[model samples]
Target: MAPIFSLFLVLITEFSLATAQQRNSNISLGSSLSPASSNSFWSSGSGQFAFGFYPNGDGFSIGIWYATIAPKTVIWTAKRDDPPFHRDSKLLLGNDGRLILQQGEDPEKTIAGGSQIGSSASMLDTGNFVLYNSRSEIIWQSFDAPTDTLLPGQKLRQFEEPNELFSSVSKDDHSTGKFRILMQEDGYLAQYPADSPNLVEYGYWDSGIKIAGNNVTLNLDDNGQLYLLNNSDNMKNLYDGGNVSDKLMYRMTLDADGIFKVYSYGLNRSDDDWKVEWSPNSVHKCDPKGVCGQNQYCILMNQEALDNVVWFNDPYSILSNTSRPDCEDECLKDYDCEVVLHKDDQCMKQRLPLKFGRQQNDPVITLVKVGGREFKKEKQSKVLIASVVVLIVAFTVLAISGVLIYKYRVKGYKKLLNSGNEELIEDVILRSFTYGELEQATNGFAEELGKGATGTVFKGLISNGKRVVAVKRLETVVAEGEREFRNEMKVIGRTHHKNLVKLLGYCNDRTNRLLVYEFISNGSLADVLFKSETKPRWEERVRIAVNVARGILYLHEECETQIIHRDIKPQNILLDERHCAKIADFGLSKLMNLNQTRTNTGVRGTRGYVAPEWHMNLPVTVKADVFSFGILFLEIICCRRSLDPDLAEAEVILVDWVFDCFDSHELDKLVQDEKVDKSKLERMVRLGIWCIQDDPSLRPSMKKVVLMLEGTVDIPTPPSPSSFLSSI
Candidate 1:
């Protein structure tokens, strides 16, 4: 009798505790949670949804997820790209009505409701985590700031600041992925690659509805019906799962593979039971614009010809061929050929990085050149046999010639020891060329390449016309030119990087000061980015930007003595034959000792690309170079000059215009017709804004800049850059 009484009391207490938690679903102010704590999340009244820390990677991410599901499905994540926090991190609804994330000893970061005050928060059954005011008016909600998934009853309003949903990285990793769905202002619901431009041509899928009003919206009703609504009260149903029961759950998601899908599950069913209710018209996975990576092709599973596959029309060469097989054979023989399109006895060969590829069921026969892996294996076996035979013969010869080799090595060592220091220096380091030699190589400096503030560059040939070089001759050989000539020689001679132009030799005979560099086949970045009729591809531009950043990083941190390339504009960035960017013109570079970090210097950079500190009479550091690189980064993104007078009044200054667009959530204006990755563009834009901050301390280090550009680190929202300019 006593044991039964004790068990009854225990059951009653447990039931009471559960009832209390359900009733108090509206979390009171000052409530806090932690991943390490047993009560890590706040559950909805029905215990179906929860809001708090969830295990992600090796750490925890704050998000709202389906609590009852076996594998909890994350619907919304806070700071998706930010690194996950450790167990010590706390998510607290502060007494001051702000939701703050406290990660150990780091600065307290506000998750939401920074500006508005809240009285309480609630994890609603509808999957919304909302903050309420004193009168219980909703201040902010997770539904308003979505990440990846959309629940029933959520509305993706058109013309809103952020009417888009980025897919998760994967089912296990909830970080922002490589695809997005946008409810555009032009009354079209479109899907594009995360990094591609927001132009119509770049979109892989879109709703065919085109209306001329801003009242368009994408809605998901509680009945599992997905649709579009306009001001006329007209509804275009995308998917109708008529009258779903309350026990059923549904979600519309932009999948990681660039597919928009609708999924449904029964509350009583097993956790893994999820049925696809709707998906875009039986489209092949290869129909998307960016499904395949660069220099790769998408093939149908059945070996059937793609319905309507189209590649970028920019063919390097077009030839008349008799048959399709002949065209394929021709492309396979040509190493430069990446793709070949055969139609009506015409063979069109395209280079690598086939762009704008999609399925359209066209009549053309497309053949992609793939590597012969089996053939390589066979060739490798033959080479292995040859190498073994060569090694045996070489070993036999070496064993017989050992005495002779020893004598020759001893004689060479004696000669090296007897050589003069001057001779050794000339042999190991830079070669000192005579003025007459440089004149002969340059053909009397007749073919000029370009002219700059300090020197004129001429195309030249050395080593009997086998090696091409660019010889730069100092202009006046007076005060500035003399300083520049010596500066360039001293700075560039010691630095060696793949992205830095190589210095082969120098000539400083009397008044003739010249420096010879490896000739780059492609023109300056400025010419390719802005002056050319056809802009370089977006991927190429991104690679070029990273190349330049790495080169700058090497100069600022990796060198024996730190150097700042004061002028980091597009004009000073040269492209090699492979379109690799190389930093040129070290004339304005300033060297710093290992111990020194800052130096007082006058302004030495181009007008549009100069750092603000240069004009403030402040001592400059490596951050000055970072600032210049920032301006150059923006130019590379938009393929426009920093300062253009022939543009609109508000858009004259590139920085001012870019900040305005970013602030207004109109970054689409920057790359109007260009195809780019939207996520990368935003990341780069944020990084660029940070780099150009007025305060040097506000800018990230060159190493951090490289990481940010390469998508390794998350970029935070940058403060307005126009404040300092306005004050000025």
Candidate 2:
């Protein structure tokens, strides 16, 4: 009878404990609950969330999650690192107010703990799980640490702090895998080291502005206004373009694939689907790690170049040959240098000659302070010399006034003739062609030999039946202007240099302007140098480069007004049937005095081939034209474009690489294109390298380039060019 009574007492004690655990909604110290209890853990707000034992793939944990959904989603977990030991898990509120997770109905398997009694857990409406201790003090909170998503009031920390990263999705999973966010020193957001620092990526605002903060509340509206909230009191408007009212709630997350996107949620959708409202880093690859590549820029991808340059002017780089409206057109065509590592390492501009009519550098000014006594002393000496010269000049002027008028008219006529008015007098050297005659002779734009960035060249036969002519229709708006047109005929018609393409006649009918020249059956120097077959031997290439240089030298020194062809490239150098080279394309050419250091105004020329000084919009000199000729000299020796994809791995820009080769003794390697003769290859390579030194002062003059090619004078040892290549 006593044994039965003992059994009943044991059963009652166990039942009483279970009932107390189930009824204890008001959590206090020393309280305990079993996983089987109906109301073991209560959340702070509406029963939308509850904290209790939850089972994952193989183990169980104490987590807080939304209970309203059909399939509950765990928002925050307590024992993430240490899961329950076995099937039996119990939740206990200890005397210190810390929540403990114990396993298997045994006291030995307690794995993890939480906050003190009065501050164990609270679920905010924003979906944050905060843990507080006694006296309503918060100890640990889920808001401070995030997993995959950002809530409404929470912040997506900036990327500045070192080693601040996000934790992985799981111990076995290395993804989302410790994603980090902190305010960067550059005041921007960057993701680093998925595997290594060399493999990191960066992101910024559409305006190219960097973001800096500990936390950010990215608020989006149906209208596309994005607000980044630093905290409850501090906030900044980030963007505004989308329709925000479309959804009740939105989420912004940084995915494992280095993709940052924003998604919208609504009241109607039970499970919110992520919509990629913005992808900040999608097109950021293939360029220098933090920079956009070459002509490739980080415009809004939707904004115009003129509009975007104002916001992000520093990274705004324009490659050669790129026009304004089509800023990214060429960049989009090539995807080679898309993902780059260093911003400064990305190639921007290359070596090219300064164009004619550019503004020259400012003159150096010397400022000195003059005392009152010094100024008075200098003034007395100037007055004495001025008085004697004035009396002598006055007597001579009285005798020569009548004679001076007669001579002035004669001098004016000579000036007009030099200005090229001689074309009006057909009896003079100048010749003219009618518009109808040229069009018919050319067969209405017959077989075009080639086209340039500016104009087209067509092969034509003259009506005389004995001579063949190549007709060029200068494709410039002012090509047929009465003044310039006459000037071209007068200057070119008078010159008779064998190295120059002969100007037979010109047709100017306002709209129809054409230039007829002695036919060169062999097209352009570019075609032969870059000839499809590559049959031109090194000696022949050397011969052609020298001939072109001689032609330009004649124009600069021998011609009446040093004619600078402003645009000098291989195509501008035409080849005759005899393979003799003649310089062509003088529409953008400039005529200036021999003594001038530079010509100012009017920008014109091809990119990559234009000199670096030209970018400053400085006045040009004959040396500028010489610079272009030098580039042409190099181009002829090496059969490749200035910018070639084949050499991208080496980052070998034509000019810089040539200079580099000169330093490394590997210059001979550039001549390996099967067509070059190994015997003369070394000489030709040396000649080419000498022509493309980065410093303009270091490059040989055209006459010298011609002389060196012919072995007339010993070529001097060029400067190391270490500094010049560094600028690129």
Candidate 3:
């Protein structure tokens, strides 16, 4: 009778949970949270805090903050450093006992997480979202990784290990800004600009320094006094807030102007406003230099005539002293640089929407740059802004994107001109060619190089007949394709990477979209790896990896605007005569500009090479490319494809299979050539694993990845490849 009653109770509990999930009104595991979902947010039982995604800048951030506040005061972001743009993002309390933030339908990026055992997560009244273990003990808490705001029970610390402890988020965009409060090596709390990974201090107080311990921890209480607990043992007064009411909530926030302050919340009544409680020393009083980025000077503001050259013109730019049109033309060429100023031959440019006011003013007259967004729109507006073009979502048996190219140039623009649009013609950097000219070069489509569903390629000779190029003729036009073409033209026109394929020029007519590229004699990496009997030497493989890493780093860090390459695989890696890697296909990163069209329609990547984040629907960052590179690295060295179902004895999955070799200490077996340097091979293996760590934070930046390959830095042993479940 007791067993029967227990079964009945279990049925009731299951039914209740099922009902709650189906209603889409509660926060729980298996619940889908989205901007479009009705149950997008989860509030604590007391209704003091909420956990969900919110609009931030041009993107969105999954965060936890005060529920009752206007404009939403965010305290913690799952990925404070990397937020997802407007797209498909999801949050999950996984059955594996972890909390995951998914971006753009990619499940691989677990942006933030806790223990992955028998743990459960919940939003508590204390404004802490936490994960609990089997015994209900808190295993991990959001209070530990505070971004800009500090609630009552949170603590900020600095470890003896060199690391950036806390950084403030931008007040406008909610992105990581310049302001930072870090625990110095001497145990003095100081503020610095978050420009680099290494700590650079702006100011520090010597009186409160505590150099005795290995680490220092600090926290704020409900009463508003900030205190330091050295070694978590000795308590010391850092800031004494006299007679603060306990009923009001006090928060310490770092403002966008690079200042730290304390604010007390309103009383029980609605009319009370927040009051300032405490602040840092005199360092934050003035507008700090270096906060306004480089290539600009800082001076005291006076009452007289002053022009902020950086603010009025642009931030980083160049110019030549020719004519007013030429000077402004230089500034207008910059994608985002808006303002232009010129005097004599010294043309100066800057970006508007300045962060700080400058005291010094230049006499140069600043004018809105020509060829600006307005000018571009006016020029493009002449061309027919066609209705949204539809594309068929279909796939064939062969490649992820079956499109390939051959060398040819078409006199395509002549055809557009012949269409009776003479006044619409304008001088552009990328030239247009006629279809007859291309047909003459390609020998009337005689040489069929490659064919895909959407495009076809042919081999062709230039009018000079000295050099050859690859000509790809796109068959259809889609909204995404239009965006991709524009992005590709804008990016490759200015970018010059030794490891990146050069875009020679392109032709744009209504139906046909053709692109010309420098032809390479050798085929893609896939063709060589799969067809050739002799494998590429180990040294060559290492060089290719480093070269590819350099190109990726340039796009992510070195470039003015960050570029995230959604697809990275061997097929897209073109090989030159020297066996060097040149990343082909602008379609890779350009597609990232558009939100995922349909979950099942678009090709995220080739099946095995796609990162887990894409599958889980998480924020796609530069790390997505790193994950693919890791797979490529292993594939190149191990002489095996990522997934080969035909293999016997169940050795198909490359990452899992290689890690199995690492566990057995048979990593040396990866190499085919005995002449390969053992130390270099070992470094490559370790670095590859490091790049593919399950957590995005665990993956090293491309800069560090290059240094490790160059033997400038030590490579630590990598954790196991993050396939949650597998068997040999």
Candidate 4:
């Protein structure tokens, strides 16, 4: 009887143990805080965040979104790159204490993997999804890895260490986009294009200015402003926000168009509502990246400077002058550019260079939203300053002297010709030829090398190779052009500078005018600077910069008529086989008595290369040429075009950007091209900045510009240049 009773007790205990094992098998505990089911994953008790195989976009993923708030928003994602193959994908704990995402029935078919060491998945009150192991060790936490949306305590950078950044989601799709927010080597927290290894470089401030040691806290105030706080004391305000203190939550994101936005949330809101906050892009279409070509500046379309209010001009664009018809053609050649013309006003902008590094030349300020919709056409309240003017977006004005020369040469106004009044050239030799002779000799002008403002330059062998010369033909003859043609010949014929293109002979036939010059086999400097096929290397670039400086010096000081190559830009600078720069395009050239301080005239010269004083109706002097030379110098140092679209956001117009670095003594930042040698490059950047001082009296003379290029003259530190006012 006793043996039977013992057997009965053993059976009951076995039955109870079997039932408990069955229920436990269906559920697993990689963490004891909350057990995970075969079909469902659990979030820690705080309810601030949740992670599960949630439905998003077209598929599902183990994603974390805010659960405590009314509106759910995904803040962190584990498998953002690839989604689950099917709806049966499960998140479960393994016997080996690992968190694995298994597809369908196969538990080993891992879709995602996480260390189960501390494998308890919990949600912090700060909306952070943290996964820890049993020993109280954090294995993977959402705070350390952030997506596009940034939380209050999360940092946009890893201090001291550079280039560390967070990823943002592409539009609609949960996939990561090609933009990142990171700290640059130059000590600025920069938003970089995915393909661009350098900063997407919207603008930079002094991020290197150290705050109060390790106890510093980065605070995103209620307004969109981002601040660095040392303990309880404010150290530095990193971002410039007008109302960053009004909101309860703030998040900054890299938008789809590569623009960065700072968004703010109302009280106790889950996802923050955002406004423009700040955008690096222009409000007026006129000041587009490439609207006025290589040397032109874009004027603002609207007079007002406010956010969300776009200036109105038909087609939303404008030009600085209406003289250069070729400006349109030059603008179209840029890769990431688009042109819009309205009522004679033209605007060009970057076409959202989807490929990274392509839009570096045209930076736009993109503002994104976390809770609200992306910025689209909407009614924005703005204070109207004044009546809307018929603002100009694009126009190309010819030089005043050039225009005068045209008027004086008109057929009906023969008295203003000034044909024989040669003020600069002493002994004038004149030769006339019929159209037939020129056409026959050069094979119908078929041996054409290139064209300039004056006319086409054809390669011709005169006297059956007695001398091979370049014949330049002036196609159009304006009423006042006769005097300009005469002045041009006098200036080049008498000037014997090695840096200037030499004039050999001349031909004038009523409407047709031709000048013979020494033939240069190599092409214009524009080709070498822009076209990669003929791109000049570091050594070649330095030599070209030095050679051009010498030529400017000759025009300003040594020439019989102190000449200003008014249209001084890469396109106007021609290169010889040895890569020596020769100053060309004297059509816009100005002549002044030697050592004269000023000459008043309408603004001339290419856009980006023109000096700021020229815009102020000030006297054109050697300092103007110095400003141009400074632009060219930096172009050579960076191995990029002057007024490049890439540096647009940094507001890096040639002189201003260089002077900023010079004032800071951050010379190494100018060597943008990785291929260039560092030691040699810094010297060139320093020299270039010195040549472009704002005060005309403060600028170095061309004689000094040449000496600095030659590594002989020591350059004093340059003062900060005035910020370039946006023209578009």
Work out the TM-score per prediction. Answer: 0.51, 0.40, 0.43, 0.39
Winning model by lDDT: 1
> Global lDDT of each model?
0.74, 0.51, 0.60, 0.53
Off by over 4 Å in 2: 1-429, 479-481, 673-687, 722-728
A best-first ranking of the candidates according to their TM-score comes to: 1, 3, 2, 4
Expressed as tens digits, the lDDT of each residue in 1-728 for candidate 4 is: 99999999999998887665434322244432112334444454444456666565656656666665445556666657664345655555555445665554432332222434443445555656655566756666666666665666665443332124334444445557655556432223444444332311212112334343334444454455676655447557767666434544556655543455565546443544334555444223332222222212222334432221121111213344432333344345443233322112223222221111111121222211112222221122322211332232221221000001111112311221134212111122333346666666577888888876657889876543434667778764444566776766666677666677777567656677777776676778777777765455555677788888888888877766777777777877887654578887653345677667666657777777778788877777878888878877777776567666666666456556666666666656665534444445566776666666667788888898778777787766565655552361
**Candidate 2 residue 516 C-alpha distance from true site, Å:** 0.9
Between candidates 1 and 2, the one scoring higher on TM-score is 1
Residue 80 shift from truth in candidate 4, angstroms: 62
The candidate 2 region of ten consecutive residues with least summed lDDT is 374-383
**How do the residues 446-474 of candidate 2 rate in per-residue lDDT, one tens digit apiece?**
78977776667787876344346778787
**Pick by TM-score: 1 or 4, better one:** 1
Candidate with the larger TM-score of 2 and 4:
2
> TM-score for model 1?
0.51
Better candidate by lDDT, 2 or 4: 4
Candidates ranked by lDDT, best first? Answer: 1, 3, 4, 2
Give the clash count for model 2.
48
